[model samples]
Target: MTVTQVALIKMPAGNEYFNLLTKAGIVFDYIALMWLLALTNGVLSPLFPIAYLVVMHATIYWRTKGAILSSISLTAGYSTIFAVQAQFDFNTTFVFILNLVFIWIIGVFGSLIVIRERKHLKQKEIFHELMFTDYLTGLYNHRHFQEQLRIMTRARQNFLLVMGDIDHFKQINDQFGHLIGDEILKNLGGIFRDLAEDYDAQAFRYGGEEFAFLLPSIEETRQISFFDDLYGRLSSEKFSKECLSVTMSFGIASSKSGILPDKLLGYADQLLYSAKANGKNQVKFESRYTYYYSKAKEEIAASKQ
Candidate 1:
């Protein structure tokens, strides 16, 4: 197979890595300890090398499962050394047993610390999700939307702001009860999720009955077909056993509007209001030049007068 295909095939199963770098560090530490043991053989205190051995195994235990392997390998290495020493003097056997016990104790304590650290990290992830996710629609919440706007503004990336709201959402709630209205919201959220994944966009549930999208790196010319497809899907969606159809109104503003993120949101929101005012189930989109041109013409007329 081609190199590219082989690389793809070898992709890790999960989003996390095994931390091969940490493993490499462990290997280096093992080699350094071996070198120290060789240099100090039958000269200095054997306890000095034992201290280094405990530290090396403890370091690996702090992060991963390397502790057990380190413990086993160190035990076997010391056993071999003591066995040779026993040919001359058997007194080194006591130190061998002590070495095994001390290294394992350090490994166990390091494993405990690693467990606690992982638990704390998992809790933080859960809290972050709760803080930034909308419970009802399972989409990014308004806080996350605001944060994303700030990030996009700082990065100076081009994006299109699309505001959408269900048409007569309150009427649907009043007519069919809030449950059906909720189902409609969920269905629309699902549609938005799929669209966002397909188009490399971010979708947010701005508030009750309102949703927003950030279409990153998309050109104005690419929006018309997307809006067309979106409207088609929304209009044809049936949310209830009665096969009730729902519609939504959208307003889109391009990055060419040259407005701040907050202003982009406000402008798109205003256009959405205009859609609702003119007629429901329609989209209203405008470039920055349209409003700028109108304002300039009005100023020119006023100056002439």
Candidate 2:
């Protein structure tokens, strides 16, 4: 019975079938105990109170309706044993009635405790979400970003850190307004969020107009393909009438063994600066290679002509 209780507690919640099976097991245990009491001709009657413990355990996962049903089932089973034994004396009858009342009371009280515990768990979840989430962009906040980076660094896990900044963001805000700029930022955040989901990566808003992506180590070709997709999507996004389009510059650095988190971030930041210096709306990597979108190259060539 102890092992059964432990297994039930360890089972993940919200599965109706599993819960039903556990409840059935508890009922079977009660029936078996009652059978023993009858076979012994009331010699084991003193052990009947163990039924209360079973009912109490059921109430943990069963909530109010389940608890009440479990109590009723136990009472019916016990009454059958009482009838079989023909124990109709005043003392036995009073003790049986008292036991039934205590079972109901314990079931109701145990359900109440379960409800309180659920509420506490929900509160904790909400608190954790607020702490780790960025309110404006809905990405992970900078604090979470730093913490995750530190964890990966401590574990010496290989990854790619890509730092991105919106190109000419201040100019856009000055030309249009902060509201339009904010909308642009929110849209870009959504794009990053989708990309993260697709790539099984983490994205964060690393302060104003800057974002970061932590991607698992992959082949160079795949990394370039990811950057190409990102650049294409950003170039196609349409903002307000005043602001036709926007672009971002990125700097990517691969993780190495024995490297500190701060140094990795700094190297990525430097690469980002290099992208901006060469021309906005491009990506620079630690390999000292600069990547440009095909359309961007054509546009640059056209402007030169």
How much is 121 displaced in model 2, in angstroms?
1.6
lDDT tens string, model 1, 1-305? 14433544576645254344434555666655655665666222464455445555555445446567677767666666556545344445556566668777766676666677778999999899999988878889999999998788767778888898988888888888888888888888888888888788999999999999989755544565567557666657777874378877888876643458878788899988888787767777775322221143354455458
Reference-based lDDT, residue 32, model 2: 74
lDDT of each: 0.70, 0.84
Highest lDDT: which candidate?
2
| Clashes per model (N, Cα, C within 3 A) | 0, 0
lDDT of 1: 0.70
Off by over 4 Å in 1: 1-95, 232-238, 242-244, 256-258, 287-305
For residue 252, model 2's alpha carbon misses the true position, in angstroms, by 0.2
Global Cα lDDT for candidate 2: 0.84
In model 1, the Cα lDDT at residue 203 comes to 93
lDDT of 2 by residue, 68-183 (tens): 88888888877877787787998888877888888888888877877788889989988998999887788998999999999999999999999999999999999899999988
**Model 2: residue 256 alpha-carbon error in angstroms:** 1.9
